[model samples]
Target: MNGWSNHLIVAPILVPLVACAILLVIDERRRVAKAMVSLASTIVLTAIAIILFAIESGPSGFEGVYLVGNWAAPFGIVLVLDGLSAMMLLLTALLAVASLVFSFARWHAVGAHFHSMFQVLLMGVNGAFLTGDLFNLFVFFEVMLAASYGLLLHGSGQLRVKAGLHYIAVNLVAALLFLIGVSLIYGTAGTLNMADLAARIPEMEPDRRMLMEAGAGILGVVFLIKAGMWPLCFWLPTAYSAASAPVAGIFAIMSKLGIYVILRLTMLLFVEGPSAGFGAQVLFYGGMATLIFGIIGVLASQALGRVAGYSVLVSSGTLLMVIGINDGAVSSGALLYLVSSTLTISAFFLLIELVERGQDAGANVLAVTMEAYGDAADEEVPEEQGVTMPGTMAVLGICFAACGILLSGLPPLSGFIAKFAMLSAMMGTGAIGVPPTAAIWSLIVLVILSGIAALISMTRAGIRTFWSSIEGTVPRVLVIEILPVMFLLGLTLALTVQAGPAMQYMDATIRTLSKPSLYIDAVRTAAPTGGDVKSSSSEVESN
Candidate 1:
């Protein structure tokens, strides 16, 4: 492979890091230059992401493992660009572009470091996805969380600050737990590289193996907290609701990062032996409980932001459940569901902000008049000249409807196609002697009910925003803001139209994920330079 192609893994992390650093030195007053640099960086990032995805999605077992500084594996930092990480990088780049464009409307000017902080956030997310070692993962996690803290509180508001603080505290605890777990695992297993750990575990002494298990258990809890699983997820809604529109939209992928880790680790580490799939039962029940709670939250939500938050929980919960199920078919379906849902909700959050802006002027006035006098007027008010509605509102309305359809798993969209794949995988096509397992039955029920609840929530929120007797003036929406939402929803539409090929890709990726041996062998023999191998306890050393 050519040098550039071989190093595709680092491109995602590097472009944003360099751009944002340059942004930091530029005076905040130079808005035009900053935007230009930021846009150009995102364009490059998208190209790099597409390239990496293409490389990983090629012939089976192909992965780009860049050992930093040309050092050998386990001893030096290595970046693994595989199908899963590449897919995440692509999704994140798309989100970054959309969020950055939307921020240009007004949010970008809210603070001095908005552009830099955004690029830093992308750098962290891409790093976390690309890192092949446990320690680097934690470092990347901290980076992402720190950037998020600033972004969440970018705009001046008491509620926003309060929510940001809460987010900070919760994640602080997760980080601490993350450190402890990593320390324990490194001590027990004697290496931080993921494949090395997998290779060592099977040969480790019993007591050390038990210690590793305990550490992994603690680490799993950290992922659960980040995933916003059930009781641990109380902070997600408030924080998401309080953040500015573009920030909240980008934050949609944050939780999915946790799900991605859990899926990766569980598949890689727990492939055989007594502890195979160790956390299956907990993830199964916990995931189901989370889905139930999310359904309740969606049904009871009063605001569109809160509804978006609960939808995140639902998405996280579904992936967790599918992981627990541990079947190739289920995993493939969940992967599709993951892509469509993230794009749908990211666009939805941005749409909510635009729709709410229009209601701000006349919302309270309409409310008080309705309570006191039964209506804005005893009779209908006639339309007046020069009161023409902004075409922007119509665009926002269409995007919102598309989001609703996607979120609720309605037909003629990728959402329905994804859910149908999952359901079909669970229950075969009318074989008299075949019967679904209890877990499959329960999952089927929860998935359907969650869709129904999402429908109800979106319907109520849409009606209140669009059909209420509010005499609000048309909101002055910007073309930049509307374009991002269209772009994201348009991606969702593309996924729908291309479901067949998408599902095939998903199936191939899942097959690879199911085979831990394939991953272990790839990593073990990955050193490009000649290396040494020791007795039963193997180590690779290169000159």
Candidate 2:
């Protein structure tokens, strides 16, 4: 293998960092030039991610760590590349590409630091996915959140700003919780490297363990907020609805990042600890409530953006519940569901704008203005409709139908396969004598009811927007804008087509995740590759 192959893990983070820096020097008005740079960076990042995914998922692959600044694990920064991180990096790249492409339609130009902030957000997300320690996780989380604040208010509307302020305030509190939790853990356990902490936790003193538990509880609260668990997620729908289309599309992945951390850390740090998911019951019930609450919100949402935002809650809730199930078998399917649902909701966010364009913004003002100005001749021109059915309407309709299928977990798409896999995993093992577990039953019931709610909500929204709106003007959508939506949905279809291989990947991922020993050894004892500094594994013991 080539020497640089060893350094592949860092590329996802560094490539975007460099791109964002270069973009800072460019004039914002040079839209095409800036876009070309951003596009190129995304292409490169995606290529590297695909390569990493293939290598990590392939036979003979093993968990690998890249140490930063020659520092060893438990004491220094390291990036761990495993199935979970590899998949997340690829997912982030794909979303970045689609959102960046869609933004070229107008959102990118409307913002002052669109490209720079977008790339910085990618850097943060990739770093979060790859980091092997809690400290870097917090750092990257802040970076991602900071960039999102600007992106959320990109279009500078009053609603967006108001929601942005609320979003900022909420996250700052979450950040405080995160810091306190990490500090407590580090103070008690003497390390923050997840794998090392996993090793040390099983042997900690009781008083320190009690302290750690309190800290971990606070951390779980923070994650639930980030993951959009119910009640804590009251800020989500409004904030997301207020963002511009492309920005909101990328933000779909943000909540899932929180879910990923919870899943990853719970599997690693708490798998063998005495407490073993101390607050898991809360997560399970909270997730159920979140799913139910999201369904109700979806039903009540009058705007398409609000529905998309609430759908994020649905996806997060489902994953949280699945993770809380604490079964490695069910988790495999949950991972699949996570990928499909995130892609679907992102496509939904982008589709909402295109779908709403033709709807009356406020009283169909252009026609009224024309009539009021006594421009009777202008109104008499009978407003050209290109053909019997406009192409834009047809394209938007097709995309909307696909999003509905994916979101509702309907057939012939990955959503159905993912949900079905999860259901089978949950129910297949019900014993002959014992009543079904409450958690399992609740999961089953909520999953079904949520789907039904999504179906009804999408139907009503579709009918109002598509069927009854024949008199509404045809939306003018550019090919660039529409293509991103199609690409995202197409990826979901591809997931459906390759369900066999995808499931196998998830199976492997779950197996690795459930065993903290492998992760611990890889980080604390494994030899460093890439540009990482070499150090002794024994440092973990001393540290």
Q: Estimate each model's TM-score.
A: 0.94, 0.93
Model 1 agreement with the true structure over 388-459: per-residue lDDT tens digits:
445776677778889989999999999999999999988862355578888989999999999999998887
What's model 2's lDDT at 483? 93
The best candidate in terms of TM-score: 1
Could you tell me how far off, in angstroms, the CA of residue 358 lies in candidate 2 after the best superposition? Answer: 0.3
Indicate the residue-level lDDT of 86 in model 1: 82
Error of 2 at 300 (Å): 1.1
Q: Please give, for residues 1-543, the per-residue lDDT of candidate 2 as tens digits.
A: 235676898899999999999999999889899999999999999999999998897333354678787577667798889898899899988998999999999888986989999999999999999998899999999999999989998889789999999999999999999999988988898788888788888788889999988888888888889899988999999999999988988898899998999898888877776868866788788999999999999887767888888899998899888887898778999999999998999889889888888887642344344446966454334455654667788788888888888888899899999999999888777744556688899899989888888898888777767754635788888999999999999999999999999999999889888878888877776544434535544654655
Candidate 1 matches the true fold with a TM-score of 0.94
- In model 2, residue pairs whose N, Cα or C atoms come closer than 3 Å (at least 3 residues apart or on different chains), thus clashing, are 70-533
Cα displacement (angstroms), candidate 1, residue 152, comes to 0.7
Query: Model 2 — TM-score against the truth?
Result: 0.93
